[model samples]
Target: MMSKIISENKVAQVAKLIDKAKNIVIVCHIAPDGDAIGSSLGMYHFLNALDKMTTVVIPDAMPDNLLFLKGTKEILNYSKYPEFAGELIEKADLIFCLDFNALKRLGEKMEVAIASSKARKVMVDHHLDPEGFCDVTISHPEISSTSELVFRLICRMGMFDLFETDSATAIYTGMMTDTGNFTYNSNKSDMYFIIEELIKKGIDKDEIYTKVFNTNTVDKIRLNGYAVSEKLEVFPKHKAAMITLTREELNRYHYRKGDSEGLVNVPLGIENIVFSAFFREEKDFIKVSLRSRGSFPANKVASEHFNGGGHLNAAGGEFYGTMEEIKERFVKILPLYNQYL
Candidate 1:
């Protein structure tokens, strides 16, 4: 049985809205991750199956690794085609905001357009402190992923029988990726039950795993090796590990969007290392990814210092500065989190 995380009244209201709406647009956050893409595409496929005019909009370019998912080619990028995305939002009867907590996470232009739209918005996300922007907010930070919440919501609406193979694939991808292939934030038994149901829907778990994880390019592999062998720094006193990469170094490797996907979690393999941080230099800011084991508050570090927040074990934030400056700042902040270590 699905958990009662979403109230029955809210489910009924959402179902009524879905049934009444003719044109539906599903949207996700900026720099879409697997959970964001998976939940959006999963809803797109499901809504299309219901004979609704469905559209999926993304704020920016998605990682190339996610291109293999069904219906991804049909997704409209706001950064690439703002006019069309704006038109869709304007004409949408009901908008389903998936995988993000705030409208700002949709980027400036998209957020403005969405905020100005008359469409009734429903948010389905697993994030902390959701802003009161949507008509119906289905925010549950304790949930594993937005994709899993999507699955539970579908089942709660008595639509499990209508779930198709492609939709199942999308949902499974989100659940798998968000949990790091069932490595963390996946201790619940219901997660496995949902996997069993998706498997019954004809999704090969092993193939999905291979497609997402084992499809790395040679350049990405080389980059990982170099980052680990040379760039990785371990601070044993703080039980932390960090890896910082510059734009020049990335350009040398012909770095792709998802090249550094799992690089943040590598240093946790060390015996006493409970915390890991990966900093990658972007065009104007340094992207931060944090991961920790046990009861360490990775999210606290991200939120208090780096202007970001997420789960306790896995969180991310960004720093606007040079690579050296960000690394120095991180080192300086280590003493504050000494209790967590």
Candidate 2:
């Protein structure tokens, strides 16, 4: 039997909230990753089983690689249709903020809209330091992903019988993506039991892995190659590696949203390279993805240097700074964590 990490009181409270809700809107973090999309759509499908009028809203576009899921086409992008997304929030009696603790993670404009909405909000996230915004916050940083929480929450609320294949597929995708396909933060025995349950629901794990990881385009392959061969920098002394890709360089390769999904983890494969960071240039900010192996705390580097917090080995942050400044700051900060060396 799996251990109960979530309190029964919170589960009962969430169940009561779900019982009283009719219209529901689900939102996730900006640049929605697999866990965000998986958890959101998983809950979307689950609520539909109960005949709730549900809508899934995203702050911006996700990588097209995730489009193979059951209901990607049905999700609304707030970046493209601000008014309509706001309308959904306005009409929603309850909103499920999945995979994000702070409303600001939905991007600036969508954050303001959701914060101003009359709908009661519940946050289901596996990130650190949740903000005090949601009425019911189900934040568990130790969990593998928010998708796992979604599964646990449903079973805890006595609705596991309603779960089906579609939800299983999405929830599995979230867990797979968040934990780097169970390579990190997934040593717990109970996690395997959840996977067994998902498999019983008819999710083809191999196919999902192939689709999510192996199905890359020619440009994506070339872009990744160029990023590694040309832009990758290794610090043997620090046992670290860094990759920086600018907007111009990305445009040169016909970049798409998901082109660099696993690029951050590539460095860890190098011998003795325990820490890695990827800096992708965005219009307004630098997108930071950090990864590490063994006892190295990548999240501490992210939290202290970039104002972001997540799991020890995997975390992300955004910085509003120039490329030169980011590089200098990273170099300056590396010595502070040299104790890990």
Candidate 3:
């Protein structure tokens, strides 16, 4: 049996909303990671089983690596179909905001639509300091992933009998990827028990791992090699390593969306380094991914400097301006966190 993490009252409130809702839409954060997509899709499947009309709207395109999930094709991308996505939000009777804290995390347009909608909102997430935008907020920073929270929430609602193969696969993917395949933020004994339950649902964990991590293209492999060999910079004094990828270099390698998935974690294998940062140049901003070992608070740096926040060990931020400018900002901020190193 799993421990009860959500309050019974909150569960009842969400249950009532789910029961009353006719048109339900699930939305995840911008730059949807594995957990974001996983929780959204997991909820989508669960809702489908309940015979509710369901739609999954993502702020942007998901990583190519994640398209294998059962319902990826049906997911509405706000970036690609703004009008349709907006219409779905407008028509939704209930909205499940998964894997994100603030309304801003939905990006600009989606945030506006969700905020203005008369639909009741429920937030299921594991991020820090969630904004009070939802009618019922299930925020647990200690949970490994939002997918795990979704699983727990379903069970609490007495809907565990509705768990099926596809929902199990999606939830397992979120738990696996968000923790870097059980590398970090996965120390709880209950996590293994949850995996046991998922396995009982006939989810082949090995196959899911293969599909997510092993199905990388040749270009992705080359991109990883170039990142480690050419762009990697180790600040031994700070016990930190940084990898930067420019748009031109990404184009050179024919970079796809998920090509740089685990690049930030590669340097942490070194004996002394405790921190790693990856900066990928996007069209308008530099997307920053920060990872750390031990008790280092990567999310603090992300929130304080880079306009982002997440878990302590793993976090991300975004920076505007040239790559060099962001690099300079990183250098300038290193001394503040030197004590943690």
Which pairs, if any, clash in model 2? Answer: none
Runs off by more than 4 Å, candidate 1: none
**C-alpha positional error of residue 89 in candidate 1 after TM-score superposition, expressed in Å:** 0.7
- By lDDT rank, best first, the candidates go 3, 1, 2
Cα miss at 37, model 1 (Å)? Answer: 0.9
The lowest-lDDT stretch of 10 consecutive residues in candidate 3 is 332-341
213: Cα error in model 3, Å: 0.5
Q: Candidate 1's residue-wise lDDT over 1-341, tens digit each?
A: 54578888878889999999999999999989999999998888888989999999999999887788999999999999999999999999999999999888898889999999999999999998999999899999999899999988888898988898899999999999999999988899888988999999999888888888888899999999999999999999999999989999999999989899999999998999999999999998999999999999999999998888888989898898889898999999999988876
How far does residue 3 in candidate 3 sit from its true spot (Å)?
Answer: 1.0
**What TM-score should be assigned to candidate 3?**
0.98
- Higher-TM-score candidate among 1 and 2? 1
Question: TM-scores of the models, in the given order?
Answer: 0.98, 0.97, 0.98
Q: How high is the CA lDDT of each candidate model? A: 0.92, 0.91, 0.94
- Pitting candidate 2 against candidate 3, the one with the higher TM-score is 3
User: Which one wins on lDDT?
Assistant: 3
TM-score, structure 2 vs. true: 0.97
